[model samples]
Target chain A: MAHIQLPEGLPGIRGAMAFRPATARPLNDLVEILLHAPNSLTPAERELIATYVSSENDCYYCQTIHGAVAAASLNGDEALVKQVKHDFHNAAISEKLKTLLVIAGKVQRGGKHVTTEDVTAALAQGATDIEIHDTVLIAAAFCMFNRYVDGLATIQPRDEAMYRERGKWIARDGYVNVSKEYLPAEVAR
Target chain B: MPHIKLPEGFAGISSGFVYRPETAKPMRELAHVLLHEPSTLTPAERELIATYVSTQNDCYFCQTSHASAAAAHLANDWGLVEQVKHNYERAPVSEKLKALLTIAGKVQQGGKHVTSEDVAKAREQGATDLEIHDTVLIAAAFCMFNRYVDGLATWQPEDPEMYAKMGQHLATEGYLAPSIKA
Candidate 1:
């Protein structure tokens, strides 16, 4: 039901990337750095940020997929994921995380919405510069991702099971395996 | 000098928020849900996503403040911040985060750029459904934030020292602090 003429059975951004691998590589590379590189923040936390932003934008594909990913990583705790989506502050998280989410919310609305005080709260709660930097990046990046997915009118699966299954695979293989270069052209189609 | 005016000595989003407290509240509430709420992912990681997206969108205020916040909580490594901003893949992070950033980048450009495989890749890297959802939300929100700030032409301080100092203050006080709230 996407606005464009993408191949049938195409789920999310992957199909679009397959259609244009050249553009996909750089995009993939960027994700590798921001989400998977190496530092203090865990993968689960990073993914949560994406889900939070997607939910705000009402991008069904992103919200469902990331929600599944978060659930899988949290030992299949879908309820916690749902709770966070409904309300982060009330969710059982650390003070530092609460503060960071505050800032993330600001970023989602507009960078200018964030304040020095917001940064101060995170730091007080033990957030580091790198963590802060990454948070902003994550929020900023998702803005683009949401638009990209929603903009193209990509096919968003209605099945929650599909997302859970895919989340398991992602938790195991990482993004490279799913790359168009690795998958057969027909599967990509 | 910002293209728009509110009050003197104001900087970044806080300043703008102060000018219009009522309108800013909803946005703040939305950000709170997107970021602070717990899930499989950590707050630090979530903040990093926000910073990355802001940087991609060229939102100076967001890039600086969130970067500072991330640094304060996670690593406190300004170098890493610069590295991610310049090139995230080369930056020091984990495999899973790298995958998430990939999706975030696409979000910055447009959501259509993301793929099912992208979600799969992120999931393969241990990204959960909430993680993926948060990633998209972060990207989408930043777009709105970037445009909001840029559209209004909010104040942006050129001094790095100023931001560093501001970062320290922000690290100490929450966004709801009297200084920040209008």
Candidate 2:
């Protein structure tokens, strides 16, 4: 049960956006760019970053959903996702990613916390400028995302399986189509 | 002149870490994984995503530093960083990245804003599950980062030139080395 009044069967921020498609479209458009954009990092990696941050923020819905997506993408390697959530440094991943995640973590805390030395370490580990940029952006963007979802008091399913199912659909279709059924009639205005 | 009081001559997060090395190690380690780790997405692309998100959040320090870093890595394409900061969709980037940015933005606003279809769209644009996952994590993490910096009242430099200079050093030496006088 959510603390706020929200539509039934519609969990998380989707419910809020459905109530207002006028805002949803633009919002969706922005999401499209961040996740699917052609960059060096893979979609799964980006999602993992989100999951890790959500876990830290204690945004149950975001963490579960993204964790499922990451698990599914990593060939059902849900454990890796869990490892990252519990302790990213110990998680089985490349050094470069480790470096990037360190930066990401700092970004999660604050950009100022990110030092020139941090960038230097990442660069030494093979982090390009773009990677550093994306890491920061991902951290910055999720802050907004987490706040938006939590702020609206959206419903979050307690079942982990639910997120797994949702993640599969997301891995297949995309938010635009998933959002169609949730859109309110008044949104056309 | 910075609006806040950071320890004297702090080049980046690492210098702060040095002040308290024991606690800083974990934070630094996490950041390293998030930013430098190899993934399906290119480093440049990832940086751009971070820069754009920071810009949207209006975290001045993040926007400037990350933007400069992105600019440095993108072959002096500071314009792209600016464009993305202002409006990512209108910026020069791939369709896949554009889609990812959409998701990143949603994550920034709140994770629930992201939908299965958003992931699907990213896939359609050739985003793997990993890419999608990383995007979400990055966005979520940045939210924490923004709050931490703003929460602590960290200093933010106003000069664009300073950022550029910092970018050059970062591009060359990375985040761990401080070439600037601070």
Off by over 4 Å in 2: A1-4, A184-189, B1-182
* Local distance difference test scores for all models: 0.69, 0.67
Q: Which stretches of candidate 1 lie over 4 Å from their true place?
A: A180-189, B1-182
lDDT of 1 by residue, B60-121 (tens): 88888777866766657888777777788888788788888888888777666777777778
Candidate 2 residues B99-119, lDDT tens each?
Answer: 989888877765557776776
**For model 1, what fraction of the real interface contacts is kept?**
0.27
Q: What level of docking quality does candidate 2 show?
A: incorrect
C-alpha positional error of residue A175 in candidate 1 after TM-score superposition, expressed in Å: 2.0
CAPRI grade, predicted model 1? incorrect
